[model samples]
Target chain A: MMRQEAMGVLARANLEELRGALGAWPEPPDAESLRGPEAGLIMLRGRAGGGGAPFNLGEATVARATVRLSSGEVGFSCVLGRDLEKARLAALFDALWQREAEVVDMHLLTLVRERLAGQIERTAEETAATRVNFFTMIRGEDE
Target chain B: MYVAVKGGERAIRNAHRLLADKRRGPRNLPDITLEQIASQLALSVDRIMAEGSLYDRDLAALAMKQARGDLIEAIFLVRAYRTTAPRFGFSEPIDTSKMSIERRVSATFKDLPGGQLLGSTFDYTHRLLDPTLQGAEIEQAARADVTDEDRPMPRVTDLLAHEELIEGDGEAEEGAEVGDLTREPLSFPAERDLRLQTLARGDEGFLLGLGYSTQRGYSRTHPFVGEIRVGMVEVEIEIPELGFTVSIGEIQVTECQMVTQFQGSAKAPPQFTRGYGLVFGQGERKAMAMSLVDRALRAREFGEDVVAPAQDEEFVLSHSDNVQSTGFVEHLKLPHYVDFQAELDLVRRMRREYEDRTADEGKEAAE
Candidate 1:
C-alpha cells in the first residue's frame, strides 16, 4: 500500500520534478513491454450529489503505459492527455519502487510527499480568502 | 421499361468537383481559417464536442471546417475520428461541488449560499442582427471588482436535502462496474448510466421535442430547475500501480438538476425526485432539455403508467441519433430505379384492365 501510494504521487507529479527525481536514481532494470503508451478516452463517473448513486459525468483523454521488470514485478503508469514520455518515466519509477523499495522509499518517496504537501498548502492558501461565515443573533423580542 | 443507370462514379466525381468550386466561391474572397471557426463559431464547435462525446476544441473546429459548418455533420466527423482512438484508464468522478463556476443559477430559490453569478450569457441579449459586427474590431472589456477567491460553491439541492424534502439518492455498491454504451449494444430497460450516456450524445432538437412533449401534459413532473451550472472541473484518474488517483486535466461541462414533486407511495413518503443532465461543453439548453426528458423516462421506476412517447425508453433512445436518422432519410435519393420500375409496371397493367372494363359496360348499356 505504501509503495502504491508513492507510485501514485510519482505518476501525478510535475513532469520536471519527476524527471529530476529520476535523474538521481541509478540505472533502471531491464523492462519488458507489457502494454502501450497509447492515448484514449475514459468515462468519468460521479455521484448524483457527491455522496449519491454513481452516474457517468463525462470522458477525458488519458495516456497509459505498463512495463514489467525481469524480476516479475509489474509497473503501470497512466497520465492525463498524450504524454507518452511522462507515462514511461512513471512506469519505470513504479518498477524501481517495487524492486528497490528501501532505496526509493528513503530518497524518492520523501520528495514526493514534500511536493504533495506543498501543492495542498498552495491550494489552501489560494482558497483561504474566499471562505465565508454565516451567523445568527439572539433577539430580545422573543424573550 | 427502365434502363440501367451507368457512369455513377464519373457523375459523383464531377459533383465533388462542383462542390469544391462552390466552396472556394470565385477565389477572390478571404478563405475562412480554422482559427476563426475555433473562436468565432465556437458555439458550433462546443455542440459538436458535446454530441460527438469528444472534448478536443481544436479537433471539433477542424471537423466544423471539414463539414462546411454543418454542426451535425461535424459531430459525425468527430465521432468517426473518436472510433479509432484507444481506451486509456477511466477517470475518477468529477466533484462538481468543487467546480470553478462561471455561471450558476437556481429557479427554486431566490437567494442561495453561493449567490448566482450570471457570467457570460445571452439571456438578456436582443435577437436583432448587428450589421456593425461584420467587420467589427473586438476588444476585451475590463470588468470591475474581479474576486480572486477560489472556493467550492454549495449546491442548492443540498439545502432541501438537509430538510429531508428531497429524496435521497441511494448509495451505489462499491466496486460495481458501470455499463459502457460504446462497447455494448443498447438493450431495453437500460441502466441510468447507459441512459445518461445516450442522452448526452443524443440530438439536441430531438431531446427538446421530447422535453416539450412532457411539458404539454404527456408526462408532467412539475419540475423546477434546482440548479444549472456551467464551469470547469478537474479530472483525476486512478493509477493502480500508484494506489491513488491524480489530477489529469480540467474540462468545461454543463450540469442541470431538476427537482420534481412526487406524491407519497405505499413504501415511501412524499419527496422531491431528482433528474440529472450533464454534457461535454457549455451547453445549457441541451442539458436542461435532457434533464426534463430524463425525468419523464423515469416514469417506470416511479411506478407511474407510461402513457407518453417520451416515457418510452426504447423509442427515445433508438431514434435520438441524428447521424443515423439523416443517413436513413437521405438514402432515399440513392438509386431505387428497379423497385420503382416494378411498381410502375403493376400500376400500368391495373389501369389498362380498369379502362377495358369501363368500355365493356358502356357497350352493354348502348345495346
Candidate 2:
C-alpha cells in the first residue's frame, strides 16, 4: 500500500513530499511545531522573505513551514501568504500523506487540491494587480 | 436521471489502466528491443548521450525506444535519470592532441604535417538517393597504410604560431572554477564559464538555428573550421589515496576548433581567435554548431558590440534546455480550470462595473 501511494505521487509529479523531506525549505518556516514520521519533532521557522531570497521592509510577507510525519517523512513547505500556521499545517498534512498512505482519503485529495488551486489563483491575482501601479506615462501631446 | 456517487479510488484505478494501455498500445505486436534501437538508430542514441550528459549508449538507446523514438523525450528521460546517479569524481581532461586519428581534417592549411585524411564524411558525396543501400551492403574500399615517417600530425595552430597570425596561448589560469548553472538559476550577462555550461546542454536545433542566423549576416564573424577531429581519447582520474592517476574506460569524442577573424583593438592585436567545441561520440554537426556559437558568444571578451540573437547571453541560456522547454510547453495539458474560473469571474465583474458607469453617463446626457 505504501509503495502504491509512493508510485501514485511520483507519476502524478506531486513531488512536494520528496522535496520537503529533503529539508529544502526556502527559509526556516515559522509555524506551530509539528511531530513528523521519519523526522523526529519538527517546527517551522517562518520568516517574511522573497522565497528565501533577501527582502527589505515593505516587501510582501512569505510564509514558510516545516514538519515531520510519524512514518518518518521530514517535510517543509513554503507558500506566499501571512498564514504561517495554515501553511505549516498544510505542509504537515502533505508529509503525513507521504508517510502514511491511509491518511490520503479521496475526499482529502480533492479538498487539498481545490484549496491549493484557490490559493494559487489569489496569489497570481495579487501579483498581477501589484504590477499595474504607475497610471501615468502619458504621451507628450497630453502634456 | 438520478446518478450514484462514483468512488474516487475506482476512477483513479481506471485512469491508471488507461494510461498504461496507452503507453504500451496493442501488446500483441512485437516488443521493441533496446539493442535494435541502439544499433539501427545509433544517431538518435548519440544525440541522447550528447544532451543527457551521460555516456551510457545502452541507456540512451533504451530511453529512445521507450520514448517511441522521440529524441528530445529520450534526452529528458536520461537527464532525469542522470540526476539520481551519484557523482564519484571528475575525469582528467582527455588530451585531444594524442587522439589516434581515424578522421582528421583542416580546412585552413593545404599541406600540413598530418596530410588531411578525408575519412568518412558526406561532404564530397552527391546527395543522391541510392536505392541499392536500402537492401545491400556496398563493397568495402581498400585500406591504405602510410609509414610513420611520412605521416605528420602537426596542428594548424602550429602554423599560425609560426606566421604570428594569432596571439600566443597565455599561461593557464589557476584554480578550477565551479560552474553555476546546475546549482543556481541562470542570470543575465553570464560569465564565460556559465555561458559555456549553458551552451553544452542547449538544444541542438535551437543552437543550429541561431548559428545559421549568424552566418546570414545577423552577427557575422567569419568563421572557418580550423580543425575537426574525431577519435577515441583515454580517460584518467587521479585518486588521492593512491597518489597516482589511473585509467578509466575510454570514450569517443568529436572535437572542432573554429578560427574566426576579429578586428584588432588597441589593447590586443587581433588575428585569428579560437573557439573550442567537443561532444561525445561522432557528432560533427553538433560540434561545428557549438564551435560557431562559442565564437559568436565571445563578442564581449573581444570588445565587439553584441548585436544579434547568437550574441545575447540571456536569450541563449534561458531557452537552451530541451527538458525545461518540453516540460513547460507540454504542461499546458494539465488541469488549469480553477485558474480559468477565477479569471472568468474577474472579467465578468469588470464588465459589469464598466456597463453600469456607461449607463449612468447615458442617462445624464439624455436628461
Candidate 3:
C-alpha cells in the first residue's frame, strides 16, 4: 500500500524529472520491454466549491501502463496524455521501486516530491496574481 | 374492407433512381466537392456533427452530400455511421480555460480580460444577398492589419468568481461516477452530466424554440451571456505503459456560459448561477440555445418551480431528436385503411339508428 501511494506520486510528478530520475538509476529495469504501454482518456469529475457534490467536468485523455517483475510484485503508472515513453519509464520505475525500495526511495522518490512541490508553488503564484478584492463605499444616507 | 396494397417494388426502385438523378442535377454543372462543403458550408457541417454526436469533418461533409443538403438527414446519416465506430476511450476533460481563443465575447461585461474578439461573425452584416457570389471565382485578398496571436484568455465567469458574485463550481468528491447517456438510458431527475449529454445532441431547432419560449415569459430567468468562446483545444490520451500522456489531436469547439441571478436559499447565499453549453464545432447559436435550455432544466435542482415545457425534462429530452420526430410525423403516409374502415362501419351504423329514431318520432307526432 505504501509503495502504491509512492507510485501514484511518481505518476503525477513532472515528466522531465521523472525521466531524468529513471535515467540515473543503476541497472535500470527492463520491465517496459516485457509489457507495452497503453494510452487513452478518462472523464474528469469536479465538485462544487467547499466540498459539494461531484459533477462531470469533462473528458481528459490519460496514458497508463503496468509491468510485472520476475518477483511477484507488479508496478503501475498512469498520467494525462499520449506520452508513451513517459508512461513506460514511470511503469519501469514503479516496478524497480518495489524490488529495490532502498535505492529507488533514496533517488527517485525525493526528486518526485521536489518536482511536485515546485509545480504547486508555480500554480499558487499564478493564481495569486489574478486574485482581486472588491469593497463597497458608504453613502451619506447610511448614517 | 380494404385489399392489401403491394407490387410497388419496381416503382420504388425507379423513384430512387430518379431521386439520384435529381440530386446529381445537370451533368454539365460541376459537382459539389466534400472539401467545398466542409470549408464553405462549415456551419452546416458543424451542426450535423454536433447533433449527430460525431466529430469527423470529412464524414459530416459526406453525410451532407448523401443527404442532398438536408441537415437533419445528414445528422441522421452521420449518427447511423457512428454506431459502427469502435469506442477508443473517453478523452480527458478539456480545460476550456486554457483554450487558444479565436473569438471570445460577453454580454454581461463591456470590457473583459480578453477584449471581445468579433472574429468571423455575421452579427454586423446586412442580410442582402450578394449577386457577385453567384458562380464567381472567389479570390483571397490579403489584409494588412492581420495579427495572429496564440494567447490564453481568462473566462468571464472566473472574473465574477473573484468578487464572490458568482457561485463557485461545486466541490466534487474524488472518483465521482459520471453518467453516460449514450450507453445507459436517460432517467430523471437526471444528473447534470446526463442532462448535458442529452442537450449536446438534441435538435437545435427544438431547443431554440424551447429557449425562446422561456425568454418570452414562459419561465423568465433574466440571463446574461457570461461568455461565448470559439477555439481549439488539444486532446491528450494517457499511455499507461509509458506512464505519461501525449497529445492525440485538436478539435474546434464552441462553448457558452450563461449567468443568471439566483435567490438566496437556506443552503447557500444569493449568487450568480451558471448554465454551460459546449458543442463539437463553431456553433454559437446552438450553444446559446443549449445553455438557455440547460438553465431551464435546472429549475428543479435549484428548488424553483417547474412551470414551462423547457423545465420538464421528459418533454424536452424525449421529443428533441429530429430523426425520431421526422420518422413519427412522416409515418402518417403509411396505410391505415383497415383501422379507418372499422371507424367508418361504426359511424354508418350510428347514422342509420339515428334516422330510424327520427322516423319513429315523426309517426308518433302524426298519430
lDDT tens readout by residue for model 3, A1-143: 37655666666666687777777877555543555577554544322221245334334334566777666567666665457777777777778877888777777777677766674444333333332233356899998
| Residue range A84-130, candidate 2, lDDT tens digits | 45445556655655654454434244444455456434433332222
True contacts kept of 1: 0.35
Which is the better candidate, 1 or 2, if ranked by TM-score?
A: 1
Leading candidate by lDDT = 1
TM-score of 1: 0.77
List clashing residue pairs in candidate 1. Answer: A4-B242, A8-B242
DockQ (C-alpha based) per candidate is 0.23, 0.01, 0.09
Task: Give the CAPRI class of candidate 1.
Answer: incorrect
If you assessed candidate 2 against the hidden native complex, which CAPRI class would it receive?
Answer: incorrect
Candidate 3 Cα deviation (angstroms), residue B113: 1.2
Model 1, range B1-367, lDDT digits (tens) per residue?
Answer: 3345687798899989887777667688888888988888877888998888877787888888877778888888988877888766567777778887777778777667766666667776898889999879987532333344434677777767778788765577788777777888899999777788788888999999998898889988888899888877777777665566766556778888888867687878788887878887789889888989888888888888999999999999999988788878877777788989899999999999999999999999999
Q: Please give, for residues B1-367, the per-residue lDDT of candidate 3 as tens digits.
A: 3447787899899999998998899999999999999999999999988888777687789999988999998988977765654344655566677765666777777767646766557876898899998889976422222222324577787777878778765655578776776568878778777777778788999999998998898888788898888876655545454566544445677888888767687877788887777787899998889888888888987888988998999889888878778878876777778878899999999999999999999999999
Candidate 3 error regions (>4 Å)? A1-143, B1-6, B135-150, B353-367
How are the candidates ranked when ordered by lDDT, highest leading? 1, 3, 2
Q: Write the per-residue lDDT of candidate 2 for residues B135-202, one digit (tens) a residue.
A: 69767443443446323354566556666676443333355443445557877777655665566567
